[model samples]
Target: MAAFPYYDTPAIDALNAQAVALLKLFAERGYVREEPAVLQPAEIFLDRSGEEIRRRTFTLMDPSGRELCLRPDLTIPICRQVVQEGRKFPARIAYNGLVFRHQPGEPHRATQFFQAGVELLGLEDRAAGETEILSLTIEALRVAGLKQFSLRIGDLALFGALVDALALPDGWRARLKRHFWRAGYVESLLYWLGHGDGKAKLPGTRAEIEALLDARADAPMAGRSREEIISRAMDRAVEAAALHLDPAVADAIAKLLDISGPAEGALISIRALLKTAGINLDPQLAAMDGRLATLKSLGVDPGQVQFTAHFGRNMEYYTGFVFELWARDKEGPVQIAGGGRYDSMMEMLGAKKPVSAIGCAIRTERVLAAKIAGGA
Candidate 1:
């Protein structure tokens, strides 16, 4: 597909047919369809999403002086809509629409595409929420006539558990979790934890951060008060001075990121690794085991699943149980669908309290491509 798709009438009809089938499937599962505006506040995406999305987003100043952007992805917008509409919980919302992003230097990559999926909000049972979404995505692909896909699963909760086990300072914990999705940054952070000499200096001087803390009554700067920023800076300085990560703990984290294999085997490997490090993650491990068992009960073959300890997708909002479904194409395995649980996202997007949520999005065009390649 080109940067902009221009399909003939027949092609458009065929594409709509696939999308309609998906919407129907979602409705049958009780996901009420929603249509969020294509134009959304730019800061919402920039602030909440990961760096990968922030750079690709297309932004412009509206006549009213607010920065607006075409929706980069439906999940954020849908969640924002839920918060805006004061929707009650246990909400099952479905959406199918075009999202826009700028694909610099990749003209062949479509800048606009159709993503259809459902979000289960306020589902107290996280494992149940995940299983429902995963089963629905797989079934949707099969319903669209593509089969033979493999599952790659990961859980950010595992890493969070590890961080908590280490008893790291609050500031350090926040920084580590925020930057977890970056490719090489985690290694740098681990290195800093072990060797403070290699640590990058804080951006501003002690006096500067303190002065911001002392001052009062300033207009909202980028949605935060002067005090919040100053307090965070001060916390980092105090935290950095307070602790040093044991080299052994750093080694355990590195080893964790290196793990990848069959699902059960990988979990066993992780359990062993944490045990040796004097950290117990049995609760997290058991939760994972329960999820896999639930998936199998729903007909997802365990043999076809692989677990990578470090595979958090580009989206930083995912707090747990992430996964990707890959289908073979002319080149190799292509990712046709992916999603995960982001329980904190609703609160971040303005919910009164934390809302348990999980969802997945299917790239409709890629589904079609994989179908054609498999001669289905």
Candidate 2:
């Protein structure tokens, strides 16, 4: 496949047929089909979706001089629409459309791709919400003729629970949680905490601070008075300089990140690891168990699920229960679909209060290819 895919008549017909089937299934399941705009405000994605989206987004400036972007994914746009419309709770929304991303060098990846999925907004039942989306996603793929794949699951809430149990300083906790999604960064942070001096220095040294103060004497940055900005920098400098993580605490985080395997065994290992570290996450662990049970009840085989401790799906908005479904193409294993619970995103998108949101989308191209390869 090229970055800009060229579909012939047969390919086009197949995709159209698959899309119709998906839309029909969604309607039967009580989802109202929604068509969010193809272009969205760039800032919303850049600020909330994390660095991966920031890098891939195709940004443009409209004639009005406002920055806009081709939506990199459908979930954010759909959620934003729901918030803007003041929709009632537990909104069952479904959509299928072409989403754009810049995949410059990867010919196998499309710059513009057809995606179809559902978003369940304002649903407070966490376990039930996750089950509904995941099971529906599986059914959608099956209807599109997919046969073999495995589910990879992770929970940011679980990781947050572990961090809270460690009893670290506020600054250290904030730093760890903020960079949780970046690859290799957490390991580097752990190493720095263990080896470096306890004190951390801000970028503004005494001379630098004086220069900045002189330069900004008549100006305020982002509504912050010069005095206020300098004061905050100084305060954070003091707090950061005093921040340090205990070697035991760092070790605990390392051990947790190291645990990953079959889902049930991973849960057992996490429990044992927490016990040895003298940290109790019974409530959190029980919640995870409940989700797994719910998944089983919804027809997902426990044997097909894998769990990893540090797998926060690169989207900063996801607050818990992230997942990806993978299938092998001729090259290797490729992710065909993914989504998770992003409970905090609604408030970030201007909702009056937090709204529970979960969704998953199939890469229609990949799923279609997989279906064809299986001679379905």
Candidate 3:
């Protein structure tokens, strides 16, 4: 009967009540609640939010020839606010609002959904911040009455560090980091890096370019003269020639990326892989162990989490820890909430300096849907 797909009175009331409950929990944790404007500048989302968000953001033009967009997600806008206000260290912020995004498929998925959560900012300890964010997410979902859920955790820093520890030069390291999240590319990369052309004349591996720095001697050509074409070839070579990688190294890293299991044994497997490669993930591992202890102290079961060495979350902004909470429905498991640590993103968002930030956002719509399907 309505012109557009939207919640009727009862549904709207339910969503509002859920938002209120989550906000109340955040407030109790010392997070000051703030309501941000819905319309935001387009440039921020376009430049920093990654391609997935950029494509779906609803953009518009103002009378004064300025570009604006409906807030695709709340994290960036909040960070933008923190930057603009010049907020002091360790800001605890709680916000609840409707965010607009274009969901092309999945009829049940909300195009515009109500999200409520908190962001812990400017913390000095990365492990402590990640643990707190994850613990709070678990508590909030429990409060919302979701009975069964899984938390998949990942760390880009750990994965990146392992790749760095490999013998690959900086160019190869950059390539691997950039494509780590994409499907299928990783496996192909490993084999190609280790075994390429019969001649195995990949640019970085080629005798002509010595360790990617040798290109400095090449004359500038066309539009990209200052080692332009050479630099481009080096990058392309890095992309194409996994040919130079030793079979042992490629297999070792591949095995590392494949590590995934319950937190109980996941840590053991990860440690073994790192040790085998002579990779020193001591600092990151120690931080991870600290996070587990904290989670246990907070009454969360470490066994419930699944850790993946290669699993980077959807958002490109995350640089350290990442997590998602999913509850099973008639269809399958659906993600109801997610968050991660982006220690450097705030500075990119206009902050004078980088801040250690971790936060979780709950999809009130998904939470409710999953509950109904689970007979809650």
Best by TM-score: 2
Lowest-sum lDDT 10-residue window in model 3: 197-206
Reference-based TM-score of each model: 0.87, 0.87, 0.84
Model 2: per-residue Cα lDDT over 30-62, one tens digit each: 999989788889998999989878899999999
Cα RMSD to the true fold for all candidates:
4.9, 3.6, 5.1
Runs of candidate 1 exceeding 4 Å displacement: 195-242
* Candidate 1 weakest ten by summed lDDT: 197-206
Alpha-carbon local distance difference test for all models = 0.85, 0.82, 0.78
Q: Count the backbone clashes (under 3 Å) in each candidate.
A: 0, 0, 6
Q: Global CA lDDT of candidate 2, please?
A: 0.82
Task: Give the runs in model 3 whose Cα sits over 4 Å from its true position.
Answer: 1-4, 105-108, 196-244, 301-303
Q: Tell me how candidate 1 scores on lDDT.
A: 0.85
Clashing residue pairs found in predicted model 3 = 192-242, 193-242, 193-243, 194-242, 220-225, 221-225
What TM-score should be assigned to candidate 3? 0.84
Candidate 2, residue 357: lDDT:
88
Candidate 3: what lDDT? 0.78
